[model samples]
Target: IALTDIGVGHDTLMAEVVPGIDFIIGGFDGRGIREAYEHPVTHTVMVRTYGGVSDLGRLLIHYDRDAGVITGYDWSRISLLAEQETPDPLIKEYVEKNIRSFLKRGVDNSGFEN
Candidate 1:
């Protein structure tokens, strides 16, 4: 497994160069992978999550302990919907406080309006 910020091409290159790399997770410049991809040559699974805090990527690997290798995998991207999900009180409070501070500073709060 590897965590990288060098983007997809490099991530794939790393997998090609290195042996026994079953997975690579990467993101760059707020860009994200809409779907997971596997390299044809190396058969390494690569996935990335959205850059901000709104979405999460999940990868579940099926491993063979006897063989010491990955057998298969499952991947998904989960969206955090505010209307469907309950917010943590502490985080909500902190965000609200920051919004108030930005407003006080005339920081153009229009962009943050939901």
Candidate 2:
């Protein structure tokens, strides 16, 4: 549910009353956090997305085959900022193409030039 204003408002309460919901995606609070809680009946995982496209949240959920229950999870939030590495050719080309369109329209005035 896109809680683009309050950042998972009432989600904790929802977890208390609601049942059978496995994952909850919430964001727009400009901060990202991954938290897990054990309700009376089940466990719930909640993720808050970061502001804009500056980062990507990768979540890995582990489950046991023998028992029908969620075992655990591993999560990482990766930054999109360059960290001194050669850019991928295909991605660079695509970015250049899109930037060229913006440059042609004079909308890209952030001092970056080809």
Candidate 3:
């Protein structure tokens, strides 16, 4: 199966419905999540978009603590790759934008929305 290729267990991935970005987390062998958090190799995670790829569209992000590189999924399209660069702009911009948007709406301080 496609998941086996990526080592993502089908029965595990926990389905979470984020108001802005829908994604799946826990319920896996930990390898998938560990790898994602580790940034060993680039991986794609699916998200539900109202007018993007489809009901569920795959979004890629690269996370590496060593290089401080937080990369978006389309690394191939980048001139400088995450594996080669120290800090990727894609990751930085994503984080900044998301934070700005969240603060604008004044996200609730009472609960862990995530």
Best by TM-score: 1
For model 2, how does the per-residue alpha-carbon lDDT over 11-92 read when each residue is reduced to its tens digit? 6566556677776655656766644334555556676656877677777778898998777887677777677456899999
* Candidate 3 or 2, higher TM-score: 2
Ranking by lDDT: 1, 2, 3
Tell me the whole-model lDDT of each prediction, alpha carbons only. Answer: 0.83, 0.65, 0.37
What is candidate 1's lDDT per residue for 1-114, written digit by digit as tens? 998889767887897898888899887756678788888898888898877766898999999999987789999988775876788999999998787777766766466533
- Clashes per prediction? 0, 0, 3
**Segments of candidate 3 deviating more than 4 angstroms:** 1-85, 108-114
The TM-score of candidate 1 is 0.64
Candidate 1 segments exceeding 4 Å error = 81-114
Best by lDDT: 1
Candidate 3 Cα deviation (angstroms), residue 24: 38
Query: lDDT of candidate 2?
Result: 0.65
RMSD of each: 6.8, 6.7, 17.4
